[model samples]
Target: MIDNTIFNDKKVAFHTLGCKLNFAETSAIGKQLTDEGFAKVKTGEQADICIINTCSVTDTADHKCRQAINRLNRQHPDAIMIVTGCYAQLKPEEVAAIDGVDLVLGANEKFNVLEYIQKLDGTEKSEIHRSEIKRVREFKPSCSRDDRTRYFLKVQDGCDYFCTYCTIPYARGRSRNATIPETVAMAMQAVEAGAKEIVLSGVNIGDFGKSTGESFFDLVKALDTIPADVRFRISSIEPNLLTDEIITYISTSHRFMPHFHIPLQSGTNEVLQLMKRKYNRELFAHKVELIKSLLPHAFIGVDVIVGVRGETDELFEQSCRFIDSLDISQLHVFTYSERAGTKMLDIEYTVSLNERKRRSNVLHSLSEKKTKAFYQNQVGNTYPVLWESRHNGEFMVGFSSNYVKVERQYDKKLVNTIQIVTLGEWNDDKSALIGV
Candidate 1:
């Protein structure tokens, strides 16, 4: 029998290894553990229990998860180690087979972690509680308090669209979400907890309210009415679901920042069709144009995946040229990595590792140029920037309303507060705008 008294003075730490959605869920789990009498600590701190929220979007992610487990087990051999999240849901048996893992929970099972722990009886083998993905139909609202300056509020969960180079639908289940009223209440709660910014995040947030006869636009409209002094930012949305009305509404909203992160996996129409993406290159370009026309100072970030199957050199060139033509601020380039059971695995004409790295480097250089040009444009303009807690040497860093990073001398009074400052020349690194 396990000693129940051990829980009275146990410390627990959590480490999340995925998107903002995963971080939000991990924070919710941490809050639950805290409510249940477990003292929360940093990931590297000594703890009686350690929780790893894993991600399996790429093979490298899986390898990192394994390395973290091995490292944690070596450092804390007597700790009760638990692993959960997408990697745990998709491959419970594989994760359980890893030495030093005490329990493995799936997408639906992670929420019931306390119940599962109560049933454990000092078992030597790793306990697995994964269920079929189809059975995960409930929507659990979560928000990350990992940072006092911002919180990632999970307004939606799961995905109905199974893009060819994706395993999120299989890992997180179908599209579902809470009602607009419920989500607004959650946002209010976050504001009460001292959140300066709340990022609306999810697997496929554009598909929000599909199960409740509502729409993503409706959710945002409701949230805009919240009487909190917090700025709201959408994490990412599908081009097809990012309607013109939503863009126009946000353009006029006081609380919503002038920033949008849209994923355009490929700029070539043929590659997009191969990836089963919903929108074409033309439609994506039109969306960018619309956002630029409405919110002239908007910060637009594009997500591009390089080196996917069927992406020939010619197609990659076409993609690079098309991205170069866009009036966006920055690019988040992801080198495509094959995942097990994804539709892309069966597709022919895969790009080699060396070629993938080459394409990724080209995009990275382009991203730097685009970001630098965007920063240069804001050199003379004054904007309201919300300062974060972290500082670099004597400088404090923050992001403007349009997501421009600004730095000033460190001041404790400026933390978590929005200040209006005129932008000056870029620093030596040119990574951030400095206050004049």
Candidate 2:
């Protein structure tokens, strides 16, 4: 039995790193703690417990996790520190050994944190509760509101595809999700909670319903029937799983926005094969073309990684040319970083760190041109904008229905409300369309 009195009047602090899924999970954890009589520590205030959710997408991410753990420890010396998430799941002992850490929870154990907190034996030796990734099977659902007007609902978790340079399958385990009805119920609850926009977050949302034997299309259909003003945006989904039928359905959805985020790791089939990606370059291009044909004004974002194990100089140039050929609104570029025990190390060719930065810069410049062009094409067009509660200096910000950022002079009345506005000239960096 756990004692609820121990948690009463205590305070907690949270620091989350990487991805919307992580943010949603952190929020779920926060809610659990707060419901147990713990109050969230405000800015610059110390707490009785600190939870740091770490990411291990790259080596740089691991370093950042360590830095965050240290910074939090120094700031709250008396707090019982806990570490969890992908980093902790991938390297439980390493996280447990971190200075001032009292507990480390793995993917399976994180959801059971309340029980573990009831068993803390102090800092003499940090407690580790980790399980192998292959044995992880339960599907936990999460929904969270960011500092903006958007709510991120975790529809799925984990990955089955063991892409050659990737450790997601190892860190996150197999692809799985809650049933379509359960997921739709979560969305309805978020809508009831005043969510104007909701982003479906997952490691592979398109692969949802693997455990329950339901297709992603079924889930999308159920979410669309929601009788509310809330908008839905799909996060980064695999090109192979993002079928033509799904795109067609979203194009016609009243609740779903005209926005799509797809991951195309490489532009050439050669590099793609080395990475063990499911879809070829031809299939990716066809998907992009299909989206453009159906939703002419859709905001399409693509993810690309530069300088992987087998990407040659000629191949990088070819990839750049292929990316340039796409009608994407923006590019989410990732610079390649070597990870331990991955299949990419066996590949003969490797791009230097400096070379990777150069390749990334090339793609970034191309993306800037693509985005500026996409924004310019929509200038003077009127669209409904959902103003975010978070302020931007003396200005307030909002995103159009099509995912274009628009700004206006600060207005307290505009927070969390949808208003029709005309997009105008680019601001200083042209990052967002000016609201007129």
User: How high is the lDDT of residue 160 in model 2?
Assistant: 86
Query: Candidate 1, after superposition: displacement of residue 401 in Å?
Result: 0.5
lDDT (Cα, tens digit) per residue for candidate 1, span 337-368: 99888888888898999999999999999999
Q: Which ten residues in a row have the lowest lDDT in candidate 1?
A: 1-10
Q: Against the true structure, whose lDDT is highest?
A: 2
- Tell me model 1's lDDT, rounded to 2 decimals: 0.90
> Which residue pairs clash in candidate 2?
none
Over 4 Å off, model 1: 1-6, 42-45
Provide the overall lDDT of each model, using Cα atoms, as 2-decimal numbers: 0.90, 0.92
Each prediction's TM-score against the native?
A: 0.97, 0.98
Worst 10 residues of 2 by lDDT: 425-434
Best by TM-score: 2
| lDDT, candidate 2, 1-436, per-residue tens | 6677899999999999999899999999998888889999998887999999989999999999999999999999999999999999998899988999999999998877878988987647999999999999998899999988899999999998888888888989999999988998999899999999999999999899898999898988999987888899999999999999999998888888999999998899999999999989999999999999999999999999999998999999899899889999999999999888799999989899999999999989998899889999999999999999877668889999999999888899999999999999988866677898
